[model samples]
Target chain A: MASSIHDLARHLNISIGTVSRALNGRADVNADTRQRVLEAARTLNYSPNQSGRSLRQGATHSIAFMLQPHPGDQQYGEPFFIPFLIGLQAKLAESGLDLIVVMGAPGDYQQERLRRVVETRRADAVVLAWTRREDERIDYLTQAGFPFATLGRSRSGAKSYPSLDLDFEKAGADAVDRLVARGHRRIAAIRPSLNLNFAYLFLDGYRKALRRHGIEVDPELIASGFINEAGGYEVTPHVMRSKDPPTAIIFNNDAMALGGCKALAEMGIRPGHDMAVTVIVDTPLCRYFSPALTAFRPALEPMGQRLAEMLLASIPAFAGPQGPRIMREVWPLELVARDSD
Target chain B: MASSIHDLARHLNISIGTVSRALNGRADVNADTRQRVLEAARTLNYSPNQSGRSLRQGATHSIAFMLQPHPGDQQYGEPFFIPFLIGLQAKLAESGLDLIVVMGAPGDYQQERLRRVVETRRADAVVLAWTRREDERIDYLTQAGFPFATLGRSRSGAKSYPSLDLDFEKAGADAVDRLVARGHRRIAAIRPSLNLNFAYLFLDGYRKALRRHGIEVDPELIASGFINEAGGYEVTPHVMRSKDPPTAIIFNNDAMALGGCKALAEMGIRPGHDMAVTVIVDTPLCRYFSPALTAFRPALEPMGQRLAEMLLASIPAFAGPQGPRIMREVWPLELVARDSD
Candidate 1:
């Protein structure tokens, strides 16, 4: 292994300082020379000790995506994140940065994970997803003046940061509107038990839409469950057994909606026939469901790419000539009408 | 941020050498002092410049799990990896090592990914999954003398390495036996298009089982797909249209099996009654399917934990009193009989 800058410089017949500058992407280095040095470095396997290099240069050229394992779900929100990560990684690659996925340990909270990344100087920037209503992770990053971006918006951050969010509030309202248009006055909302920011916003829209339609927002219709299929299955029966049961239900996610459909099947109540159902979808699985669920589709892969671009715009070094821009984009979700609801 | 060893030492009123020794876990340091130093380091967030430290000590205290995105599937084998990662992280944490997930760039091959991890000195060791039949990544790691372990075995490597593999061979044979017992002579197998090691082993077992039963191994009966729902949905019809259509079919994975079931449903064929179905299951979705699928279940979380243990046993530093031992384990799959097949 050509272990150092000296070895790379010697092999390339170049000065050590010139080799260092080229490797660091210094503006002073000519494009041709920089390419040659980088090629040689990669070919000869010259790895500058990352910690040492970062301490001097103040850059790691890596982005950490802090992945919080879904509670009670081993798949870890696979449908959404896989495509999202592919997009994120693809975009980050264009900038010669690597995407480092850091999943928190079991029973380990999000704040601790974020702190570990920051404390270790693991990456120059971090990308956070599954934003909570009052997110301490966001607050901590903001206070540390860290360069970071979020996949969803949060209320706890003191300063505005770059973020890309789907309008869950609109989706919830739209589901209610669609169900109400079908002459259904009793509509229930099954949200995540976890204090996710989107859950609150979705409920907000659900309540507002009911009030606008001259229907009372019943507490009995609003229920929370774990975000997985099992959670959906368990909560569906509970909501159905309520004193004033809903004729329709809006689920937090596809997994929960799938479970709810199963529960409905067990009760001999067919979705879209005996009970209308709707879900906010991210994967193609929703379309393949038995009754083909009526879902709101957010183009996850493209959205992930956009999120990376937004994050890049926020970081001063990556922001190009226009300089850093604190981006806050609330993307719209398209309602895909299907057999269910 | 407590940026260096000096800062940590000064804060604790201890010499820099003592702090360094304690942090490094050198035998010269007393247990009480080591605990005190570690606690202070956590509290103060003292980040030893990792590259500098690793350069001198030859340990990154991190393990890289190289993730290869499924060719057409966006979920990236989520059902397997999430629980696997949780178990991996939990075990690795005990050794004070973090799990660093590294995904290759789009269209980038596995060897390149492995090389990057090694050349950059990103981790002390690596944990690879989805091993190819003749994996160049395995060969490369072996050639470089890099400490590594694999989730599946490979043929290309020169030296025997650590691995934890599911007995796909046995599963394939077992599926054939079960289908034959059900009086089905015409059996079809749907495998991944990717040149994975497991697929080959599965096919080997399948061919042997067919030969043993005096049943001709028809090329037309064996089909390959993209390893996703869409792939399964598309391939199922093609297999059914064969001159000698199969009465029973075995799918490579749960996702593909689900899609195949849909295709069957569209064709007015019930999976369990008209067309028997079986799959190599990894997730709970199989149990929830309309005709709960007949699958082979590999306790993923526990297996993942075992994989970590096996990998740890291979690495000298973390191997403890038993010392480094190259581990090769073949995990079994439990046959779960259900409505389908």
Candidate 2:
């Protein structure tokens, strides 16, 4: 059961080539040499299966995409996934390479699952999406000798990993700049949770933009939570109730910005007139909203395409670099000013 | 290259087994028979080395999950996909089967991809999501003799495939029941586009529930579009603007329900106070929405587990039963009477 080629070669005391020829049924080997190797193999009960040998050689023409559960199940109810997947598939389709989307459970061992994908010859590479600060998936994929690329950069040690990201900082700063240009000084910002890397980048942009405009960043003007519409709706009343409430508000994402508009409308305040709001992710649907939203347009299609290419080029044992390679490209967010601001 | 064992046997006019034993290196065959088979093979230039033929005799032990891109780009910001995947992974984990999630772009040849998955022996079985009316995928998989289970039922001509589905009609009717039980009439229902089978089931449920209460189903009460938050938000005003506006409204899904709640609030109408609302799926985050929300609790986890079992049980030779083996499970709607009741 544990027989090795070397052991069989030693038992026959002949060249391993004769043993290989007999197993592979090569006609070049002499009859006597082939017979001798076959008899020895029969005596040892040896079986030279190709799959086991292929596993040892270590290259599977497949890649895995690790998907995190939508923060609260709202992610699937929106339309953002279609374009992102189309962009990713466009690149992978060119090489005829396969993509495996792996969804990790809350308490499931993501690292172990990733390890199995690589070790079992299931996939030669991986692509990590919705990355968080100090993501365990990145650490494990990096350590497991698998080539991987992330959709977004990690907070602490993502430099070693190849990632494609949007400049959230610039997007955020630009959101503020557009709002300020509209003669709104007391501006409020609805940000994503502080724990996320993008959230912090957005905050930095907001602060920088405010400073450049000679306005101080006030803690009272900042509201934070999940970057969803419900989060925007829930936080709007609190911001409006504040004693010197802002004339303009910036939301972390487009969905939340729509929620903010609804909240203002609920308060009998017209979004574009009495109050102004800006959002990130300038999606096509934004134009359809009652008061079309003014938001930042991140090049999500190119971002997904580049990430797929990087993962495809980084297949196992292909050569130049080992571990995750870090590549950054920022597509400037265009400010789509609509009725909202 | 096209020589078979029978071709060699016919030439010699000897037993096929004698020829097989000769080529297969079996010692039971006479040396003369072995020589004849080899000479015939050489003459014909036969090469029995194709990967597909060998794979047929060996098991790959991997499953392919061909995923449809979420309806559009806005869905990424929603939460439906993450949990469905988590549920799927949990079921696959018990059997130690690896799930290879593949995304085929719209207008791409999905059937060809499925054929390749089988031809290349990359996966032993396939699971197709987003099964549409008159689905070409189901037909292709069936004709190719591949094992597959669909996430949803199709309204196509044949229902010969194995599928795990929820009784969506009952779920829809139950929403109306809950709303009516609370003494509300003139109910409006928002549904997904009729192109999908689930949408029709939901509409049927809505009508049945109305009929049960001795009310006529009004065409004006139904709205159709993409099943997303914005869809709910945008359609609500139209419903409310009706000359005889509905006192209660039912949403196809939770995300839309949340959006409907926001829309009502914007119209200076608190959900529970101004009008009643009910949703389909009871996503985990529904409990955290400002108004909490009243929704039907579809058995997503169990549905996933059952689907996995169906796919695993299917054999390569399975032509499916004479009639569709449709496993329908109806989970009652857990009516949580909150502020939005």
lDDT by residue for model 1 over A124-151, one digit each (tens)? 8999888888888888888888889988
- Give me the candidate number with maximum DockQ: 1
Tens digits of per-residue lDDT, candidate 1, B278-314, equal: 9975466776666778999886777778888888888
Task: Give DockQ for candidates 1 onward, in order.
Answer: 0.49, 0.16
Which regions of candidate 1 fall more than 4 Å away from where they truly are?
A11-15, A22-49, A75-77, A243-245, A321-323, B11-14, B22-45, B75-77, B321-323
Q: Which lDDT tens digits does candidate 2 get at residues A71-93?
A: 64333343455566668877876
Task: Assign candidate 1 its CAPRI class.
Answer: medium
Residue B338 lDDT (model 1): 89
The true-versus-predicted C-alpha distance at residue B104 of model 1, in Å, is 2.1
Supply the DockQ value of model 1: 0.49
List native contact recovery per candidate, as a fraction of 1.
0.37, 0.34
Candidate 1: RMSD to truth: 2.8
Which docking category, incorrect, acceptable, medium or high, applies to candidate 2? incorrect
